[model samples]
Target chain A: MDKRKDAGSWNRHKIQAVWALLTNSYLIGFAQGRIYKGSLKNLCLPGLSCYSCPGAVGSCPIGAMQAVIGSWNFKFPFYVAGFLLFAGALMGRFVCGYLCPFGLFQDLLHKIPFPKKIKTFPADALLRKLKYVILAVFVVLLPMVVVDILGQGAPYFCKLICPAGTLEGGLPLVLLNESMRSAIGWLYVWKNALLLLTIVASVLIYRPFCKYICPLGAVYSAFNSVAVFRYQLDQEACIGCGACAASCEMQVDLIKHINSPECIRCGACKRACPVGAIHFRQAGKSRQSNTTGL
Target chain B: MKRQLQSSKAGILLALAGLLMAGVGMHRGEMSTVFEKAVKICMECIGIG
Candidate 1:
């Protein structure tokens, strides 16, 4: 489906734009090469904005989780976990759809009017499970288990994998801070390569990182089936037109897998339906006519 | 029908539990811990120290 024809896409982009700005509002910090030191950083943002970013005012949940787990105390990250659970239970990967800065970055990139856009591939299903593995190892296990002699575990995902940190944090900081420039090494080169690869992939495909690498997406996806606010198909109204499937950038089979974990609940399917069969059904509330406010 | 009911209950319960745990974590000063990390530029973590 042409994104221009999908009615829900416009509202989603507006929300994503506003949310990205609100989460990264420390404009002066970017100029000065310093992060926001305000108390607001204590609250975890649902999206994957790197806290190290000069303009970031809130902490990234995934980064905060690794920090809490890898701290000298080595405590389980109850706060971050609780935040994820609350957000996931409330709306599942809707956060990814409407809030994630990296997601928005990819969305904007994928809209660059490339000649060919590969929606899905043969290894898509198998490759989709890679994020779960990364979540288990890089995000959760390595931080909790692998420690230096001093018992401090590094944020392995941030250092080694996350392109957001590279683009948002490392690049700006190094460029702005002369003292930090001398410290650049092989790791910086490595991260830049990954960031470039991600950028190219984003232009050619829709949300490759979200589909294949994001740990936060992995966690939220686990709650998709049980999320209180979710998409539902009205069997009586659906005309087997397959418009929903055609509209989904994530390529979710909106009929057979209405509750699939792969769904980001972007509401493209809802707007694409000729019969208006799709609706956002909040528990105990009546069915919604449109995707507004969702 | 039964499964959706169960999932609804589970989701509600988990939300409640999250509320409780977050409150406890805040009381225990985990919020400050997050603030501490977020405030500083970690050179080694992002590999730009």
Candidate 2:
């Protein structure tokens, strides 16, 4: 553990921890079976904090959307969809960059003392499209098409795929309640296996789930180019050097696709740029912000 | 820059329309239903269902 870097050194990580803590403030019920039946539960947080977590005081937008779609009435999820669209249009994958609790979880795990860090592989570009596929199939189409005799469809992604649901909600609840352990079945076993694999993979790879799996990230990425909060490459100052791309873990070519959908707006490229060529810019503003130092 | 400017305006307008729809949904009591579900343990979400 001595070989590990000091977590306190990274200001971004500290900010991320603060955000995660602020969003999950119902710590009094952290180990409890009863969920907080508060008015705050009606609102959706901008990140992937599982609704089933005892400390969770708000609905996960994705889970909320799935629930709405899976209801017996099969009503349209206007609020959830609109919330996602509005958030995407406003901040793009900045939500993932700055707010997502699951993103922070993977980030901290990757910081653990590994002998060698893995670089972005060639297949990553192709595999990143999988999240969009998941969004289309599991999140949207499956719920819309497949319904039980009672006209209620299952929340397929949450039930089958989401490792966050397994880790944050399942593991904690099952561990705390003796009664829940007996009820666990093969599906629980399968989810645990998936969660374990994802945990191990996070240590080896940078944001493996966010890069290839999270449907929310896929949805937000669609708005990357048009989102109000954005980054600009001052072509005039840029010398076409590859320094920015060299430091970017997301495999984004900073000089080429300055606002690439794959980019989380993590500001790594901006920090790496030698000539201060990259900076933050809002959509309507004529002048860029002094966020290059960030 | 012109194209980006136009897209920005479009994005803002779309967000406003989304906000309106979300408001309508809230008025229709979707918020209460969402809260009702959120307060539950959601066994299916944890793969126990």
Candidate 3:
């Protein structure tokens, strides 16, 4: 099995998960049950790390985008949008594959030694498009149009969705302070329900929220084709055996959809390629460009 | 193949332009609001507000 081979060699995904934890470790705040209030908070992380997490030192980009869009000052989210584009161009969904804590959670859950492993169903492909719709409707349009008397729009996704917020921020804070428990309302209950659903689904499906509902992943997916860090396919070396395509958990056909929006750049295909025909290289390199089909 | 190459070039240009726009916005103190928002506990983010 590829898993045995992966263990014999270097495991890139494990190393990446370690890196993600170290980068976001503002550990003192979690110990004290208080979120960090520091200058670093002004900057958005490349991944969907929650801002309200007690241990989080950096801001979540999607949260910052919604906050900007929903503000009373009602200006375009130039900074957030620009940051997203820059990050997308730099690495595409590499952040989702390696840097995101929520994505890591899903990955770990899917590894839980269940008797039966869940495979992608027929509807899974169609459902993957739902994240894009959520990006358009909740993250972009709703935040701009749904306004209050003060001309401030609600952060609709954070309030109504975002299981990360519920798990990282709400649960911890409530458990830490019993007084806060008395203030729990319908929104809290709804959020908890969403969190419960996401937790259950992650065990049975690979990155359920990322595949069907993450607005940030949707934004980054668009840049997969042209991101500076990208996958290179050596067409000459490939035998059209379809091994790389079959290895993809996201169901991407690596030959035809080498840099498809669905790819998270997790390097699974690179490991799975028997002939070493697939690997990551600089996008603008002349040799790499000559080899790429797309 | 030519069309794909052209699109890739366009994507690079678009990214560069986006980074420039982000720089301009940051210089204009747009980041101040992000700082303000970050300092406080976002009640809505926790699903209570």
Top candidate by DockQ: 2
Kindly list the per-residue Cα lDDT of model 1 for residues A153-222, writing each as its tens digit.
Answer: 8888998999999988998999999888988999999998999999999999999999999999999999
| Interface C-alpha RMSD, model 3 | 1.7
- Model 3 Cα shift for residue A128 (angstroms): 1.1
**Runs of candidate 2 exceeding 4 Å displacement:** A1-9, A286-294
Say which prediction, candidate 1 or candidate 3, comes out ahead on lDDT: 1
- Superposed Cα deviation of residue A204, candidate 3 (Å): 1.2
TM-score of chain B of 1: 0.84
**What does DockQ give for each predicted structure?**
0.67, 0.70, 0.63
- 1 versus 2: better TM-score goes to: 1
RMSD of each: 1.8, 3.1, 3.3
Where model 3 places Cα greater than 4 Å from the true spot, the runs are A1-5, A8-10, A286-294, B1-11
lDDT per residue, candidate 3, A168-244, as tens digits? Answer: 78888777767778888999999999989988888887789999999999999999988877787888999899987
- Best-to-worst DockQ order: 2, 1, 3
The CAPRI class of candidate 3 is: medium
Candidates 2 and 3 compared: the better one by lDDT is 2
lDDT of 3 by residue, B1-49 (tens): 4644565576687789779978876876767777777767778888888
